[model samples]
Target: MNAPLTSDASPRLEDFPYRISDNVRFADLDPNQHVNNAVYATYFETGRVTLVKDRSHGLMPEGLSWMLVRLDMHFRSELRWPGTIEMGLGLVKFGRTSVTLDQVVFSEDKCVASAQAVTVLIEEATRKPTRLTSEIVRNFQPWRRRGVNVASPKF
Candidate 1:
């Protein structure tokens, strides 16, 4: 006789990688009734944290933190005040001590903004670069899109 197996599942986001219920508040608006440029970065950061709450494995370990080495952003459209938006999280590559993340913001069906960030793993104590462990590599493998070949670093 065989016993039935039970399953442990991870939390899934239906629309966005991680949805923030109340992103833009009354105070979040500029005098023009539009969210300011600085606010957009804040919102994106919020989404990133939520996206990795359950499965944002690796990079930051007991003595390490991800340092943002570079950021590339493209403003496709604008987002007004008091509107809800969803931020999508995707991975482009994961190197020895760096990871490239793709974050996109959408309101309704339209893409509002897109940003790319390259983060490097740093030691919390020494504040120097460190190689990402295999555990993180395995977890992020599933999110790597096809044809996005990120080469192994020689450094």
Candidate 2:
């Protein structure tokens, strides 16, 4: 229920209403023993799935599904095993056919990584962008906000 995160919005943990906690499994570790860099994407995917499940209750609009277009992530710190990863998600921007989601993964309140993803709603057959309908907007009101310009990735 917080205001949308504009281009200038500096979001805090309190600003996000959706949070999912996942354990750092042994399978997710790399040779260094810390969580693998690539595994963070899957962690962010967990947050997105949980958000959609909770918000839409699995009632996604017919012939519509989200497709990932871009992802930008920053590794702030390393995560260890036998710990919980607190992943937070918020709808930072809403576009005609896409939404930008901002997420952060924390280890016991210490942020370890963060990501910004652009997910687009496309027609299942034609793969064309679909407009955001009233129903679509209504279902996502819990995390609804105006779309803003995305910052270029540092990757």
Candidate 3:
């Protein structure tokens, strides 16, 4: 696992290797007039899913799929609707059967929220955790978090 980001930490968008942008919908707000806490998870998911599920990435092998097993989120600031938010994802660690990612949601240049998500690769037929193949590991190299020295992917 990567070092936990403190609430005071200000993460730069460039530190994340994979990035995407999304609009903040009015439906995402709560009674607080800001983005609902629960909605942050969805923003983080968009970053991870877009990278892993895209056929061009080759991170997903045939008969294998990824499943979210853990997610730790931090709310740094409030986000309101009527603006675009940039979501960023960085591969932080690789386990025998799981990969960990650090993700963030930034409104303008300030990080509004961040999360660490763990997803396990599973065998489609058995629904059992599956070891990561070397090919998949290699493909993920380019997505590593800046300044992170992740451990080698264990089979």
Output the number of the TM-score-best candidate. Answer: 3
Candidate 3 ranges with C-alpha deviation above 4 Å:
1-8
TM-score for candidate 3: 0.94
Task: Give residue 150's lDDT in candidate 1 (0 to 100).
Answer: 54
User: What are the TM-scores, per candidate, against the unseen true structure?
Assistant: 0.74, 0.80, 0.94
lDDT of 2 by residue, 2-52 (tens): 655333234356555678778999999999999999999999999887776
True-structure RMSD, every candidate: 12.2, 7.4, 2.6
Q: How accurate is candidate 3 locally (lDDT)?
A: 0.91
* Candidate 3 lDDT, 25-121, residue by residue in tens: 9999999899999999888888999999998999998899999999999998999988999998998899999999989899989999988899999
Judging by lDDT, tell me the better candidate of 1 and 2: 2
Candidate 1 clash figure, as a count: 0
**Candidate 3, residue 24: how far the Cα is off, in Å:** 0.2
Q: Which ten residues in a row have the lowest lDDT in candidate 1?
A: 6-15
| Candidates' C-alpha lDDT | 0.64, 0.74, 0.91
Question: Per lDDT, what order, best first?
Answer: 3, 2, 1
* Candidate that would win on lDDT: 3
